[model samples]
Target: MARNNWIAVASAQHARRGCAIPERGYMQVCHGKRAPLQRVAPGDRVAYYAPTVTMGGKDTLQKFVSIGLVKEGSPYPFDMGGGFVPFRRDVAYVPAQETPIAPLLDMFDFVEDRSRWGYKFRLGLFKVSDADMRRIAQAMQVDLALLQFESLLF
Candidate 1:
């Protein structure tokens, strides 16, 4: 389907903010580092996994909060005032529910240790296999056909 499938870690508050942008959604990983985003090409599928409701907070919210396809553009810098310029890529977000990761951990090919599922997410953003992406889509209740409509193969 997508050129690549990726999992991005962010707080639910921050993830929701990116998906809430008018017209098109956006994604910023590793605190706006452009280098990581550079590896993600247009048409790739990305899902945001939120471990908490807010950044650096203990309120656990282990859910895949956003799912989308990367738009046709390179990472661009955006100013958030106070000289905070974060590089982000445009994403076309689909309608999906925030899904918990507990049920899908066993199906993850990336996670070798079931007891350390959260360890993989520490990378902030990382590429995943197609199987992993499909599993995530199913968990999120997002239609693969809907994603395929955007030129992604199954």
Candidate 2:
């Protein structure tokens, strides 16, 4: 299959585990031709994490997944919403390294806290690939899009 790009959106925070747990937040990626998906309610139990890309922007992708959206023991092969679908193991993730997405990362107002990393502003939009999409979906459960945001975080 042709390589695909991925993007993810978050609406909540999960820093309970401290630095060891690099934040596992729900996120989605572009699945065909759709818009970014976001959580509906505030108390929604979704996932959160520090996502990363493979190489660079050879391809593009957009994802929508936030904290308090999905549950812990949820099943796989389940639809995350939008056109994106995730496998069973695609539940949560803890980014290993700080992704070299300088273009996008530079735009954010990040605050260096005691933990890993924190962004003062939203991450906005990003790009990824299908292989990366599959990998991200497997790591962080959420939907993706190539169009626009279906909703906003705040």
Candidate 3:
């Protein structure tokens, strides 16, 4: 099988504080002294933070499905599946119906649909380098922000 880069998103703040691991949680942040380099190598593992409906965002999984990035009936690879990991609702989803129900389909619909449908995810065509991510951040000139998660591929 081909190796895939896996991005792990967690709620822990350890990554921002420069800690190797969070004090508690099923997963740890990917930051700090031993922070995995920017790019996920073919066989490395890492984690980061991501938004979820539970965390105050729309249904992220639906976005994956609309983009044809994920398929149904597949086991979610990351822990805390169908929860925790939230993506931007407007940018990341497809409606189950030809047109989503009004009011219900509003941005908040993402929040309501929590656990309503099975979600699958796959990375898009953005295989960028750590240096690239860094350079972009640098060129745009923002805080030395770490991506919200870590990823491993083997």
Candidate that would win on TM-score? 1
Report the C-alpha lDDT of model 1 over 5-95, residue by residue, as the tens digit: 9999999999999999636799999999999999999989999999999999999999999999889999999999999999999999988
Ranking by TM-score: 1, 2, 3
- What is the C-alpha lDDT profile of model 3 across 29-105, one tens digit per residue? 23111232223332322222232323334643221101101211212123336555322101111111111112222
Question: What is the Å distance of residue 115 in model 1 from its true position?
Answer: 1.1
Candidate 2 lDDT over residue span 123-146, tens digit each: 433433334333433334334231
lDDT of each: 0.90, 0.31, 0.25
**What clash count does candidate 2 reach?**
36
Q: Name the runs in model 3 displaced over 4 angstroms.
A: 1-126, 136-154
* Model 2 lDDT-worst window of ten: 10-19
TM-score of 2: 0.22
Between candidates 1 and 2, which one is better according to lDDT? 1
lDDT of 2: 0.31
- Top candidate, metric lDDT: 1
